[model samples]
Target: MQKMKMIKRGAASVAIALLLLPMADTAHATIVKHYGVDWSKFQGNNGKWGYARDDFSISQIGGYYNGYFIDQSTYGTQVSNTIALNRRAHTYIYAQFSGRNQADQMLDYYLPKVQTPKGSIVMLDVESGNPDTDSVLYALKRVKDAGYTAVLYGYRSFLTSHLDLASIAKQYPLALAEYKDYKVTAEPDYNYFPSFDNVQLFQFTSTYVAGGLDGDVDFTGITENGYKGGNAQAPTTSTPATTTGKQLHQDTHNYTVKSGDTLSAIASRYGMTVNALVTLNGIKNANLIYPGQVLRVADSGQGSTVSQKATTTTTTSTYTIRYGDTLSGIASRYGTSISALASLNGISNPNWIYPGQLLKLSGGSSARTYTVRSGDTLSGIASRLGTSWTALKAKNGLANANLIYPGQTLYY
Candidate 1:
């Protein structure tokens, strides 16, 4: 059972648009305010998907009920159709939580069948069964382990009664279902929002258009976050922008931690060592990171060495978009911004990238050299350069790879 019917509540006297307010900080900047819909087998494979103006879509994959795995027959068709229309597609599991094992079984059965990209969001629809806090948390962790952004979806009453919502909100984003009435087409009134932070999506109506379809509004861009499609190829070169008479240094960027994230994994993803991350962030314990904790991934300061060559030519490279490609994922993999890619490629819609489309990547300076630091290791340097220690040794002609000292110059 999905989106259980509830008695209609009285409409609010004043409709306050809370999400339209300015975000408190830069961490909330990625939130994409777009309308979407959640579909299930009941919706069928009809051509009337009111998706002409929608930006994202979520479809139910399956569930575990009565010790049996129930699959949603329309799951594959709906997901593929949504993607085919150039919409951001995601999947949800209608979890009937009997215990931790049942939760795992539900995910194990349905995760293999998910049709979305690797880092797309996967929601756990928890409206039925007796859901304990541990079982729900375990299921969310399982979803994250499978490489999808895990979101918890439920009505306000069900979530508050069965789980510690405050604790859960700290670790995972929430998709709350609270409607004024059935078949209502208006936007969600923020006055009736649940008493919790990290509420990324609000399910406002059951019947979005002529036919019955659950309509949702994403206040935060949780659906837009993460890699969307295609295999992300590594950039060929590491290019550092230069200024006259000034030495180039590694610029820092912020990464907000998500549920089930470990320091090692974050470090590995950013091509930095654990020790470097710890030193950069002043983290006392590497294993104590929580969701929403913003960590700086690189160093920031003036370098002691001055650049001999101040002028460099701009180099351009091309990437062929594969199946399920997205501008966001391509930009991220190439260390460029979506806006930059769109501007470079003259792409009007970032979500409408197609297979075999060629995208131009423009950046980088001349050949660069790295001066080893006191605490630097050979492998650590190679990771930062997107190369291996063996390559670094070969390029620099070092007899003893382990005997590099401080102030040693290495070319990558």
Candidate 2:
């Protein structure tokens, strides 16, 4: 994080004044964009690490400062909480411009402590200390070499003045910090955007929400992309397709559980629900699975018992909404759409879902017209609608398959 300097008002005074300001009109409220916050030890663990509406959260795990390693006190808690809340959790290392070996030392100490899954982005904060281009590059290279995507973060002036911004931008994504005012800015002003092509995130305000949480808007899909989950692998099982007479049979097989295997991942791999998997294996707790334990992935001969039950059961499958549950997240998990979920559940506002509410998992109406939602791709919608993407594109007269917006209705 860049050092924040105040002029006339103190921290408390500024927060109070901001809170007292009139809220924006409901009609003119900024469209919900990809918002995120970066946290350090200063934020503490009294629970306010980030906004509830945040799309992602980045926490400082540990870093090299002056000649020693400084570990953040709230790194583990923040990372775990972010993951538990189903938001993308990223980590950063504040590196000094001492030498190339400083990057190595920092990674050695912090990599073991990082809780995010492999291939997630790990930012290298290089705003403080004397700027050295070689040192920065060394740190970024080390971060990528350790099997995680690397992003460079620094103030606009610090990055432009002392570093090769063009060359660095070509090599790695940049998170530039250039605030306009002390007040919370909902969006970044592109007029003041730094000269770069691969800029992923812009730190628009240092006081996004009261207690010094920096507000960031992801211009590109850097934070939105990648596997943002626990360090778990799905079970390895072979689905052998054979023909007995005229009917094709998918042979059921067993999978020996490995370390870091999750029941959800295993179930998803074998096309079985978590509950069905648990019932089939007679497991007490879904979370408790050990290495080398053999579990049935599918049923043989007459097909899976879950599949048979699905065909015979007339009751509508449902899910109870939990804390931090979002319509978009739930839809993706169940292979449905936000519009479908909203229409089926009598929800006028997709953003507003309460905990403990029962939501139907299946039996949404097959309407001829479909409204697009955020994160909806053409192929995904086509899949849900039981049609080819090309056919949908031609029928809807869409020029670009990649270009679609929320609330845009398409007729099939």
Candidate 3:
């Protein structure tokens, strides 16, 4: 927004002012995040992996991956008849269905002929095989009636006590599982599975690029609609029990541990990494597993959780800072603390808060100011605007978290 003019002629005065701003762009994307071996037998003969189309290249590095389903045991003696043929990553397959005729030969003989390409996404790194719960909801309704889109990958208490990725993402698409220095977006939404209304991806770096078949290949981000980008709609009022509600599409499977259970209550029901369900079940202590054991789950997602959206009438308020909000990370949201919010809205050096300042957040929600355009920052706008940089510096009152500049404005 831009407009400013003031004049004084013969008699006296005239003024015109209207400046509303926020837009800074810079971030192009094309990710690739695959994990080691089990690439349906990945093996560049030696560059290391298991077997895709050989001579490695994986689209020369830009497509992106996040798999790691080691030993989906070939579903039927062996698989992977085609893969990486022309290099294009968007995968997230991770298998393990066991019985119900191997989940009906992976939903009617190998998911409607595996040929991926056309906004691709297929899932079920189900942190445990052995059907029950109606053969994993009929193999996720046969990969969503063979059109595609279904993810339940586990880790974090075995994906919330069995499975409920926002109620199976309201019917498929919830992929979240990573290793090392952890981060399925720092879990906590009942262990993990907050909303993008069914979360699409967040495998986060698994390692082992270049293709094979489709075993270890999660790494993905490419978002336009769904993914861990979070906060899409919903939130109009209360949401900070750390957020995680809404998603009950028929109470997602209701089983309680039997047959001896406990790879830690099946990896905490469903948040998983009993060593990736003991490497998709071939086993080696997740404390020697137990019960009817059964396990499998994967997510090596690399990147892709895009966002720009925010305006249903934008609602999470508590703001008041006007005088042209200092152009950097702006001010502390509403609860106050950009140095007590520029000293309770007065203005000093906490980057001199401006733009009609005033914040308040005990319960009267109203703190909206999101300007930082031109390809925003604060860690890719807290990974594409879902949010996080200590909650955008405690809602924007940064004393210095790596200070910011170039036209700023923030408030969650």
Per residue, candidate 1 scores C-alpha lDDT tens digits across 119-146 of: 7778999888788888888889889898
Report the Cα RMSD per candidate. 20.6, 20.9, 26.9
Best by lDDT: 1
Poorest lDDT segment (10 consecutive residues) of candidate 2: 237-246
Q: Candidate 1 at 36: error in angstroms?
A: 0.3
**Candidate 3 lDDT by residue in tens digits, 17-81:** 10012211213232323332223323321123334422111111011112222333322111111
- Runs off by more than 4 Å, candidate 1: 1-17, 28-31, 46-48, 226-412
Residues 116-232 of candidate 2 have per-residue lDDT tens digits of 655666898988887667777777888788767789998878878878877777788888787767775655554455545466677777878765678887644466433423211
Which is the winner by lDDT between candidate 2 and candidate 3? Answer: 2
Which 10-residue window of candidate 3 scores lowest in summed lDDT? 56-65
Candidate 2, residue 180: how far the Cα is off, in Å: 0.6
Ordered by TM-score, highest first, the candidates read 1, 2, 3
Q: Candidate 2: lDDT over CA atoms?
A: 0.61
